[model samples]
Target: MPLSEHEQRMLDQIEQALYAEDPKFANTVRQTNPAVHYKRWIIKASIGFVLGVSLLMAGVIFKQPAISAVGFIIMLSCTLWGLSGWRRVVGGAEGTAAPVEGKQPRAERRGMMNRFEERWRRRQEGDH
Candidate 1:
């Protein structure tokens, strides 16, 4: 359901509180970029296809039809691969889901030594 005006105001207030208290922390928490950020897989495949064509020319020069056939296969495979990834690249960031949102935000807990030191400090200061 869409938030009512009152609910929207409350959410905005909470966000403001978070930003005011620790803008740096809040910004850090929001950085959930995908590890597999698409960097033109299709472009890479095009380059590979070009290289395959070059290889085919080399094979022809060397008088090896077998090598030429292999190069042709390589070119075909690369062209197909490039075409397959074309749609994904065009879809952009919205197509890919943020990794952090779907799963729990895993916190690295304080180790035993850190806890012990904290306890020791509190005791010396005469506080719990």
Candidate 2:
């Protein structure tokens, strides 16, 4: 259900107070893109996966079953972590954002996934 008018006004007041107290934090929160956040999570998981592989290799070289088992567990956890975020990124890509009723410009109204992919593409182009 939607907020009642009184509740909406109260929420607006609270938001105003937050911005007044810490505009930098408010701006950061407002500009945060969920897709970028998920991407970072996936990158961290990838690093974990690499570490897990190294551990597994070390276990084999050193003949340690316990270390190998731990490495397997780490690989499993990182795979699951990466998969969860990958699903969100893919699902978000297929979804569209509804434009807010007021204030925000069209350029600023793109979906989170769209914005992230655009940034990725730009970086790729710059790299080449």
Candidate 3:
């Protein structure tokens, strides 16, 4: 349900207060894009994958089953982590294509609920 006018006004007041209290934090929150976060996650996963591969190789060379099992687990987890958000990063970038002249951006065109639902659906599909 949509917020009442009074609620909207209250929310606006709260946001303004936040900005006044800490402009830096407000700006950071405003400018934080989900895709950037996902990209960072992908980068971390890549590093982990490399580390896992190295560990696996070391385990094999040293003939240690326990070490090899740990390496395999790390590799699996990293692969899943990298895969999970791969599509969101790509899709989010694609969805952010420049708007046509005199047109609003895609992000501005959709309601917050619509965006949330879309993200939820994407997550469900990704999990499968």
Most accurate candidate by TM-score: 3
Candidates 1 and 3 compared: the better one by lDDT is 3
lDDT tens digits, residue span 1-128, model 3: 35569987998999999999999999999999988999988999999998888889889999998888888899999999987778677665555576568655755667666666667777768953
Worst 10 residues of 3 by lDDT: 90-99
Q: TM-score of every model?
A: 0.42, 0.64, 0.65
Give the clashing residue pairs of candidate 1, or none.
Answer: none
Better of 1 and 2 by TM-score: 2
After superposition, candidate 3 runs with Cα above 4 Å error: 1-8, 92-128
- lDDT, residue 115, model 3: 63
Q: Which TM-score value belongs to model 3?
A: 0.65
CA shift of 115, model 3, Å: 7.3
What's model 1's TM-score? 0.42
How much lDDT does each candidate structure score?
0.73, 0.82, 0.82
Candidate 2 lDDT tens digits, 68-126: 88888999999999988887875543334664466355455676656666677777689
**Candidate 1, residue 47: CA error in Å?**
1.6
lDDT of 2: 0.82
- Greater-TM-score candidate between 2 and 3: 3
The deviation in Å at residue 29 for candidate 1 is 12
Collision count of model 3? 0
Locate the minimum summed-lDDT window of 10 residues in model 2.
91-100
